[model samples]
Target chain A: MARLTKIKTRKKGGATEILVLVNHPMETGQRKNKKTKKKIPAHYIQKMVFKIDGKEVADANLGPAVSKNPLVGIRVAGVKKGASVKITWSDNKGESGKAQTTV
Target chain B: MNTIRRRTFLKGTVASGFAAVAATSGLLRPTEVMAAAWPKSAFKSKKLDKSIKNLFGSSKVTASKAIKIKAPIQAENGAVVPLTVSTTMSNVEAIGVFVEKNPSPLATSIDLTGATAFYSARIKMGKTSAIHVIVKSGGKLHVAKKTIKVTVGGCGG
Candidate 1:
């Protein structure tokens, strides 16, 4: 799955607002492999990091229980109107994707 | 007296055997049995380090409560669950969702631009696990998490 779509950031009060869309399958290990007639091993994204203007701001540890194509909302303080923000995420399979935006 | 003693011994032997059998069978829950039967190599990944670096850069992330994740305490269907993450902080840059128990864990990541802060979306749940929300604000990381129980697993169960 891909990360970050339709990203938008705006000014709200004294801080900047942000919105985003994420694409992911988020498969749990319980599923079966159709071709092999065996169970597919569990594989899901496990970590995510969010940064604004090169500074670490947020991080998360994930598990298999989350749903697919998950969406998230966040607000940060002291961000400028045109500053850049970067988002990165990784899964158990060692797959990673990145998205960046300017507020 | 000999006959009564013989009967009691037989009864004791039978009870012990039954208890042993019950104990052995109790160890086999359907989920545990299924997991054990599956091969471990099927889920192994070789690119874990590269993936992490590519996504989060080299900086370490801290835990905070600037973000909130809203999900069902118990999901009836694991295939689809409605989830929402919202934060009150300003100058937000990005948000991410994670499942703590999934083999791959990192479910989705999103980046935002301009200054707008609110977002909403639906995601799939395979099993019961914790959901995490991470946000970036003013160059610092803020996070929140919630546990969700998934019933009727979505992974083709």
Candidate 2:
């Protein structure tokens, strides 16, 4: 909600490239709290679905291993310019975010 | 409280010793589990082999020269390591990244429909270990690996 997911796209002929960056803690649940000294609950993105013009192109299943404020990308073909590229990601805590861009 | 803190401190560090491997991987212990379409068993596995097996549904991966893994030979920081996995293999259905020494070796698995076999992401490294790239093409898993030395452990926090 605070840090929105950022979607970037580039088109070269029929090939399209998409880069998605989301801001999340991506906690591993193994670290200790500075004050309370308790383990921080694991919080991270669980699923990232990429769609091109409303059609699913890539689906990423993630875990806590991803770095904080994750950055992931993919390249595809057959996408035309001016088409919409969208990314929707949901975390383990049932929270989600979305972003879209035009190539 | 002192002993517990010490144990946790040792768990967050990879230079402490290999004896802490079990405790180190335990750092990724899933507290809240997963949502739909997420692979729970694969991400929960401690060992690299088991995680790979649970991810692509088989440990039967063949060494392939087609898959290319672009990552640093040595990572100054374990918290954020850049990794790019690309392959010239045809009919690629999915790609998976694994950190051999991480508590959860399975970093992320991507199912590609219209996308190419090229994928890039940043992942955490628990220690100096092997990073494996598994490309699923034509229903078979093709694999490649690169060992990256981590100066600091990321699982610490």
Candidate 3:
């Protein structure tokens, strides 16, 4: 599972822009464990969903080919000042986490 | 044999030699040899919908063109490659990245609320793969993709 950090958002051209960083290894199952010499089962976050003011906005499909840590950026419109936006994600192992911000 | 028969045989031999030379020089129709390769089965997971909702707080997402993903055309090291995603929409919420050829597939997810529409980071690549970016804005989903060629294998191949 990945951990979210450095979440930030701002207004741009009548829309809101957001940036984020995540901490994760993003191991592909093709690699073998160093100690056991056994293949590590594929375990990566498969999907992510973004919501603004309780309205579903965007979603992404993930794969294991990605590097250790990743950063992402997004922009949304129609959000008023003080509105809240939420993000959630899940891995192949069913582990999930959530983060939120106020507009 | 007679003179006419001998002459005909010589002509046939010359024509065949010319054909062979042309084929070797690639002047003839070349064959496309497709490689025998398949995606690893372990990357396919059934929890696609669940993973999306878990990341975005909702299961609904629409594909859009507002997102732009930038990656290298070729990477010498599969262990690390620079990636950047930028968007131009308002009321943005989050961004996510994926590598299509990885065993599990999902690479990373990030939450964005009060920042710019640009994000940059480095990620590992086990092999050549497609990098995808998903952006959420104004209750809509935007997507983009780029192909990256990895020379080395990061998955211990």
Evaluated against the true structure, the overall lDDT of model 1 is: 0.58
Error of 2 at A3 (Å): 3.3
For candidate 1, lDDT tens digit of each residue in B1-157? 9997567566655754653454347564422322222111112222333222233442246676666666789989867777777777887765655555555454555455543454455556557987766666675656677889987766566
User: For model 1, how does the per-residue alpha-carbon lDDT over A2-94 read when each residue is reduced to its tens digit?
Assistant: 454446676765666555445767667667777887986555655555678887665544445455665544566688677888877666555
Q: What is the TM-score of chain B alone in each candidate?
A: 0.60, 0.76, 0.62
DockQ score for candidate 1: 0.15
Candidate 1 vs 2: which has more TM-score: 2
- In model 3, state the lDDT of residue A55: 72
**Interface RMSD for all numbered candidates:** 13.4, 5.6, 14.6
Ranking by lDDT: 2, 3, 1
Least accurate 10 contiguous residues by lDDT in model 1 chain A: A58-67
Error of 2 at A87 (Å): 0.6
Model 3 global lDDT (CA atoms, 0 to 1): 0.60
The second chain of candidate 3 has a TM-score of 0.62
Candidates sorted on DockQ, descending: 2, 3, 1
Quote the lDDT for B76 in model 1. 94
TM-score of 1: 0.47
**Clashing residue pairs in candidate 2 (N, C-alpha, C atoms within 3 angstroms):** none
